[model samples]
Target: MAAVTWSRARCWCPSLLQVFRLPVAKLYLGRPTMRASQQDFENAMNQVKLLKKDPGNEVKLRLYALYKQATEGPCNMPKPGVFDFVNKAKWDAWNALGSLPKETARQNYVDLVSSLSSSSEASSQGKRGADEKAQESKGILVTSEDGITKITFNRPTKKNAITFQMYQDIILALKNASTDNTVIAVFTGTGDYYCSGNDLTNFTSATGGIEEAASKGAVVLREFVNSFIDFPKPLVAVVNGPAVGISVTLLGLFDAVYASDRATFHTPFSHLGQSPEACSSYTFPKMMGSAKAAEMLLFGKKLTAREAWAQGLVTEVFPESTFETEVWTRLKTYAKLPPNAMRISKELIRKNEKEKLHAVNAEECTTLQAQWLSEECINAIMSFVSRKPKL
Candidate 1:
């Protein structure tokens, strides 16, 4: 009789509670193993249900969700205070806690806990879609306006450097926009900077690994760029200042490129001890001729927007005051055209560029993923993060 009772308890107990040996152990208020005071747990669950109507706070949901995961029993478990909860667990030791026996229920609880925590944290961010929508419509925005979307790189505070989550947001936004016919043309950057380039601060946490920080940005950045280049609608770029690193190369692929006379461009490939990105190696030369393109890529020369225009890279240079209105008028003109007409013509021009961009992005991801995990990249990032200005 004693052996049979012990075996039943072993099969029923949750791993978190199995360590406890009855009498002295503390008990949580919510659990499946109870009878006389089970209504307490039911009351707690009911309270949680009421809170659901006001999910604006979300605290109750988070607590209930955690409790549900911590226990391996029917969600309609009993509530026991610390002393009484322990007594209930010991009392119900011989009974299976959930419908799927015990082990299966425990596994579900563990998995549910992990997922709910992550999701609840993400939810705390609150209506991310709405934030993006507001950004797209206001201040200065990047747009093909219809079927083509734009993500303006704002934040001159950090020299227009992008944050890591910002990178992820752009990627996800572009992906979401890709499916919508309302988006076709995509542009980037705003204010006085085209992009002071990737916010170097995010390099350390890059998903591909560490040593390859530069490569990861170049690789991830290329994906962000190609969404537009290969887009069925024309991609336009309006530059105002240094189009550094990835920014410098991406512009070469734009269907239309405009810059302010104050706009400048450079690629710090050599400064970072990295190689060139995109097919900037191939397309830059093809677009601007070998001699001129090499001058910019090889030297990382800081070319003024007017200089880039002269070299056949930029389409035109506009004054700062009029640049926004001029680009908007141009883009909206295209947006108003028969959508299919614009897409078909765009397809013909980008067909070959699409193939090249694909191959480059794959190779780039591999090369950069390796570099992100390297020591030099680690120190470079840490130093940059810690450094105060050398007065």
Candidate 2:
């Protein structure tokens, strides 16, 4: 029998499976038959609905294939057309099981569901513990209202500098907002500064050497930015004050950016001996000219609100005194629009470039991983921490 090519199936499918991979077990011959009753399969199906979190795309696909095999015996239906992306993926997944017996498929399905439930319970406990601490710290705040979900960076004293936990928090928040009944999502920061960017301590506090630390950080950073790129709903950035580093770099991925007149945008990658990330290398030049993008990314030039607006980086600028009121009012009205219409329209607009963005994000993160391991980057980070500069 032919083995399943899961990697190819995952790449073609525009689904959650792209986030992570799950191991596939090889099929063995002369295995003892394990009979699974219909009631057992039914129970497993119900259990899946009660899962606290999604089992991710790969697992879901496996479950789907197994379920189909159990119910229908085999994938006898004709394959879907290429343009039928969803059905094509579903067909491919189910067909990969080949001629596995229904009883075997049923048994596998039950086993998978049981494993998922047990793991889910353990994961929930750990998540609750981490969430409790995050709540107490109030480092990141997430709230939904009037069809709009808001994710706020709350560490004003630290200029909302992002920590590893904050990165995870934001990624989770964005993931939740993407599937929730929200028409739009907005990013903002509390207090005077929008965001001071990554906490240098994130690097300094690494338990492993630079190479290992850089690898791990790169993985997290890639997922963080991927969350933004794959968000289905409209994403808006409210630049309340000075925005630096990744915060500024990521604005290029937002559907719209509203900045206060006092707000500033800066990406000082070279100063830190690092390369541009968040796909800014692609987005920056595309938004403005290469020379201008070079000035900000390569030479550490910062832009005022008006300057950013002129460069096509910002949607609009509001007076500092009335920024919040103005931005909120507009967003509330925007939220009143038909949610599905907005989402589908956004998807249509992004379809052509979505693949490109993902490719660019991967390339940027890989490059950044190397830069993070460089001696110059380590020295710059150490020096910055030693000075204890006010973020």
Candidate 3:
């Protein structure tokens, strides 16, 4: 969800607020002091499901509001029309919360569930959180600490190749982070390889052939890229190992990128017979000169961490032995500063490019969707897939 804007939310709120006689101050009062810990979240959500009796409409509405706020951030959707009574009630319940921080809502959800489950034994209550549904994340693992929300690509066995589902999961993670005031920044990293880009097998195994893949891929890719473009908080990338394809191109969007000496960046868009996604077409040339951008995007040159740093593509390249510790120490220190200052600074620097980036993303997606169905792209993929691996 996008950050809640007073301008947008107020479109339907003036008369509604008057009708409810709810002072604006009421919305700000009585919020939980802190976010629910991971364990608290898991325990509360467990009890949320185990309640023997249906918590009536009022409580159910409260639950729905809290859950949405917790998982998706502020209520940014348009207010339901008066004629849509059911949805209006639901929307009103959520909108009433009024800019409550996601973390606070999470703790409130936990408190509400705990209060509801007081009659039951702890052992008998459920112990699941919505997040635990993915026992082993196919690729992405999301965690939060202090003010940093880390979205790690965890499929080291597969060189952290991205799947369609992984893209969706990442989009969701970014959305959740964007609205959470506690989340000062998003840190992306991988344990082994940063990412090898899309797993071809994920596309090949689709129900239909390249046509179906292209159509679906276009939609998902656009959504994923837009999530990055619209991300409200700082985005930081820690490149632990080599990155390929979109992984490298995406560094253009990050507020800061720290890489290990061992890390390298590569983009094989031309080799794949496809064009860029994620607005790299715009951001790349602006960050690095057009010549360097052409070398990476058009000529498919690999860039070592030090080389990328010299070209202004990477923020810093640390020694491999202390990369993680050094990068995180810097991040934690930055995370401690006043968040609004950084946010405003970032906006001032990049705000002018926002619309152009969106336009470039649209053009790229259109070209890419068309390219996906081209004979050249299909033949190139097939040729790459058919080659035998070195023993």
Which candidate number maximizes lDDT? 2
In the order shown, the candidates' Cα RMSDs to the true structure are 18.7, 10.2, 12.0
Query: How big is the positional error of residue 184 in model 2, measured in Å on the Cα after superposition?
Result: 1.1
Candidate 2 clashes between residue pairs 3 or more apart in a chain or in different chains: none
What TM-score goes with each of the models? 0.57, 0.71, 0.67
Off by over 4 Å in 1: 1-148, 181-188, 205-209, 212-222, 370-391
Worst lDDT 10-window in candidate 2: 21-30
Badly placed stretches (over 4 Å) of model 3 are 1-136, 388-391
Tens-place lDDT per residue, model 1, 103-193, is 3333333332332333444644543553465356422243434444666777765656666556666655555444345534555565557
Give the candidate order by descending lDDT. 2, 3, 1
For residues 167-253, could you state the per-residue lDDT of candidate 3 as single tens digits? Answer: 888877775565444445554555778888888775577899778998899888887887777676678999998898888878888
Q: Could you tell me which 10 consecutive residues in candidate 1 have the lowest summed lDDT?
A: 21-30
Instruction: State the TM-score for model 3.
Output: 0.67
Error of 3 at 202 (Å): 2.9
True lDDT of residue 390, candidate 1: 19
* Top-scoring candidate (TM-score): 2
lDDT of all predictions, in order shown? 0.54, 0.79, 0.71
